[model samples]
Target: MKVLIIGLGSIAKKHIAAINKLDQSAEIYALRSNPHSKSDIAGVIDTYNLNDVKVSELDFVLISNPTSEHFSTLQQLVEFDIPLFIEKPLFSKINEETQSLVDEFEKKEITTYVACNLRFLDCIKELKTILKDAKINEVSVYCGSYLPNWRPGVDFRTVYSANKEMGGGVHIDLIHELDYVYWLFGNPDKTNSFFSNTSSLKISAYDYANYLWTYKTFSASIVLNYFRKESKRSIEVVTDKGTYYVDLLKNTIEFNNKCIFASQKRIADTYYNQIEFFVKNILIGREKFNTIKEANTILKLCMKD
Candidate 1:
């Protein structure tokens, strides 16, 4: 399959790797601003301009550019009718124009899948299964990591995560928590959130955010930040049966102080699985997870005040 990737950033690299692992014969083409800095990664053919690409022969397009550029990129590709594999959060912010584009996608019947690889994690999948029949009472999700440590040798202040316009805030950048929360529990009856640059990090984007979602019988709270000295990504769910602790970093799920599920796989595995699923669905002309409409709903929840 001929695949066109719009960006060549870290996440884009991961997607390339996943695609390579999934289908070695897949011809990977990239449209990059600085195509001169062409990728050394095997199986990738870099193009200096979109005009150089044969869009008609492309099987799908992966929008892995900055969140701020997603809309413009989509605007250019909207008429192509190619399936899309968009990176998470959909956009840095959503507005009526974004909604109009979403409507166009629906009107055109585009097969678009927004990335939410966390949903493919074994631990998360197992937790979803366990809570399927349980009466949920409360859920607390915490995800934090030192921003500077995210990309060694790179200034955290210079990265997209540090800029609000580029969609670098903890709430938007770390939206997997919100995505999976919605995946597990569906939409909340009411939602409230507080997010701001409450850290010493030299960034314009909000480094910390807390969200509360209320359901009919249960409530969920999520805390996200980019300034924890020690990395942590876990979820605690209280149900009628018992509380279950999920350690996303450790890839383990525990209940009643006993371990229940452990995948022991690197987080990249989930990315691979997600891409595999996306490619498979594209081949079958259907997407079962994180469609643009579904992701837009979660994006609205994130942006909800």
Candidate 2:
């Protein structure tokens, strides 16, 4: 298969690696803005101009560019009628223009899938199954990690995650919790949020974000931050039966202090599985794997004040 990737950043590299693992013979092409930027990964052809890409000959296009450029990039490629695999947090901000673009995709029946690989995590999948028919009461989600330690040997201030203009805030950056919350429980009747730069992290983006979503029978709270000495990502859910704790960083699930499920899987496994699923979905002509509309709904919730 011939795949075109628009950006050669870290996330793009993960996708490339995942795709390669699934199909050893897949031809990979990258469209980068910086002509000087090159890929160290073997078999990746780098093209500086979009005109050099033959959309008709490609199996699909993956948008792994900065969040700020996703809208324009999608606009440029949407008319080509090629399937799209966009990285998470579909847009930095949603507006009429963005909505119109979404409408255009729907009108054209474009096959699109927005990446939210966390949904494919082994522990998360098990949690979904356990809560499939349980009576949920309340949920608490916390995700915190130090920004300076995110990428070793790289300046934290230089990345897009540190700039608000590039969509680097904790609210949008750690949107996986919100996506899975919606996936497991559907939309909330109301949402309240607070996003601000509460940390000394030398970045222009908000380093902290908190959200409360209210449903008919339950409520969920999500807290995200970029300045914590020790990294943590976990979820605690209260149900009629008991409370459940999920440690994403540890890949384990527990109920009332008793371990229920544990997986020795690395986080990279989710990325690989996600790409594998997307490839199979495309091959079988399935278009319902995390559609743009579904991602947009989560994006809208993130923007709520």
Candidate 3:
């Protein structure tokens, strides 16, 4: 498969790494607005300019650009009617007009999948399996950490995660939680939230967002942030029968019976799982493992709400 990766940043690197690991022969070309002269992968592969690159030849166009720039970059892409993997939030801010673009993509039979990496987490995939028969009443998640600690070399202030206009911040950045939570639950209407950039760390964008979601039959809350001493990512699902706890990094799921008897399972990586599912759907006429319509809908809520 031939693929063109845009914005050779962190996620782009991870995507390349994940793709190569999955399929060594997947012809990969990368593009970035600003290429680092000292970067290791700089010389080994060819990088193309947006103006020069022919979009139709590429089987997939993966846009890993900053959120705010997504719409404009998408503008350049929409004309080609090719499959795309757009990273997270459809746009920094959503409007009626943006919906039109999404509608057009669908009308033209262009498939677009939002890259919500958490959706590819082993824990969540199993949680979905466990809840397949059980009746789920609620779901909650906790994800937060220091922004400066996120990257090994860059300053937090200059990184895309710190700029609200660039779709940086807990609300937009960690918003995959919101998107996927809706995927697990349904649409959220009774929503109350408390989010702000409290620390002097850099008050450009909201660093924290705590959401209290009131579903029709269930309830949920998520505490997300770019502030903390330690890094953490966890999810808990409470059904009428029992509770399922997932420790993502540890790749373990512990079922607690009043905090007494329990069972746990360690999960293998699901990164390639998500990629293979996508590739299969593209190659064959089989049903897609994930839907772009659903993704675009969640992206709507993330950008608008």
How many steric clashes does model 2 contain? 0
TM-score for each model: 0.97, 0.97, 0.87
The TM-score, computed over Cα atoms with residue i paired to residue i, of candidate 3 is 0.87
Error in Å for residue 270 of model 2: 0.5
lDDT values for all models? 0.89, 0.90, 0.72
Cα-based lDDT at residue 111, candidate 1? 87
State in Å the error of residue 219, model 2: 0.4
lDDT of 3: 0.72
Which candidate order results from sorting by TM-score in descending order? 2, 1, 3
Over 36-59, each residue of candidate 1 has an lDDT whose tens digit, in order, gives: 677878879889888899898998
Minimum summed lDDT over a 10-residue window in model 2 is located at 281-290
Could you report the Cα RMSD, in angstroms, for every candidate shown? Answer: 1.2, 1.1, 3.2
Q: Flag regions of model 3 displaced more than 4 Å.
A: 34-39, 42-44, 257-268, 283-292, 303-305
